[model samples]
Target: MSDDLEILLTNDDGIRSTGIRALYDALSEHANVTVVAPASDRSACGRSISHAVDVHEHDLGYAVEGTPADCVVAGLAELGPFPDLVVAGCNEGANLGEYVLGRSGTISAAVEAAFFDVPAIATSLYVPADDETPYYEFDVTTDDFAEAARVTTFLAEHALDAGVFDHAAYLNVNVPLPDGDPAPIEITRPSKRYEMDAERNGDAVHLTDRVWESMDPESLPDPEGTDRRAVVEGRISVSPLTAPHATNHHEILEELAAAYRSQ
Candidate 1:
């Protein structure tokens, strides 16, 4: 990292999202920040990309008429002045567990950056979902993201010097709302839980996820060391992650290959 680092900032949420605005304000203080993000909300888009994306300059940065992954790719390849670091999100919802990471546009942007050999951070807020209060009901104001912005700023300032990215490609950060001052930060791994429920309503098939039920502070069964548990306990969860690839060697596959050669 240089004394004056070029930082590329993006998010699944639109350019107008409070989370991104908060991030831009905080990060600009420390680095030469450039924002290239989606023109509209493109959550849960994963690593899907568009080779030809329309880009327009805005007051904050360039807005792409595409997904978060598209923004990262376009920003790196054509936007010029390659970034020293890429920071995605302050996403509207928490991207926890290994399951959501594959589907989240926020996490996918970071993954795309990792493929480019540039370190990145994906940050999101964990708003507890409830029956009375819907998941999207939380007010994602700029003030609500202050704690997340602070943590991101700190990491951008010191993570490389601290050699944090040596072992991991990027970080998946989930922050609980700040109760009073800033919340404590915790290093965690994604929780292991697969809860996919589906129901039929009239002629339509409705998918229901009860995962949030377990994320409640009182009822959370997530272990103390997991990301979900940390957020439920009012702590910011930072899960060091790598891009998707097969690392484990399989003896069964090798045996099959040997049998094919014998044939």
Candidate 2:
């Protein structure tokens, strides 16, 4: 790592989002931060990248007409001053649970950076509600992000120095909304629970996902060490994870090979 720390900041909430701006302001104090985020909201876009993108210079940073993954890739590979670390979000909503890891653009950006062998962190705030409504709107301005941003900036500055990424590629962080004091941070794993249901209404079928509605702190089935549990308990959740898909036993392949040899 260089003395002058270089950080590539991005998010799924677009360049205009308050989360990204707050992150940039908080990180600028410690590192050389550059923002290259989506031009429009690309929430839950996962790791999908645009085939061709248009990049333009904005007041804050480069605004790319693509997904969060595309911005990170283009920034490190093509853009100048290759960053040593990638930081995605201060996202408006939390990206928790195993099922959400593959569907969250915030986490996906970090996963994309990890593929390039760069250490990354994805940070989000868990809004306490039953629906997708933001507890803090985009236009609302305040220093409410101080707690989340402080911890994120601290990790961004020292996580590499502490050899935190030696065993992991990226970290998924979900910070609970500030409640007068900073909460304890917990190292957790993604919970595999999912709440998705569909309803048939005449000709149109309503696809309803009740992940938020069902996320009651009192009724959660997650264990003490899980990400969902940490967030539910009002603690900051940090889940260290790898980007590469793990290889498992292939019984079908073994049977096919044996059959071919016998024939």
TM-scores, all candidates, are 0.95, 0.92
- Identify the runs in model 2 with alpha carbons over 4 angstroms from their true place: 1-3, 131-141, 250-253, 260-263
lDDT of 1 by residue, 166-262 (tens): 9889999999988887898999999988797999899999987678766668878888899999998999999998876658889999999999999
Per-residue lDDT for 95-120 in model 2, tens only? Answer: 89999988999999999999899999
Top-TM-score candidate index: 1
Clashing pairs in 1: none
Q: Highest lDDT, which number?
A: 1
Cα-based lDDT for every prediction: 0.90, 0.87
lDDT of 2 at 25: 88
Question: What is the TM-score of candidate 1?
Answer: 0.95
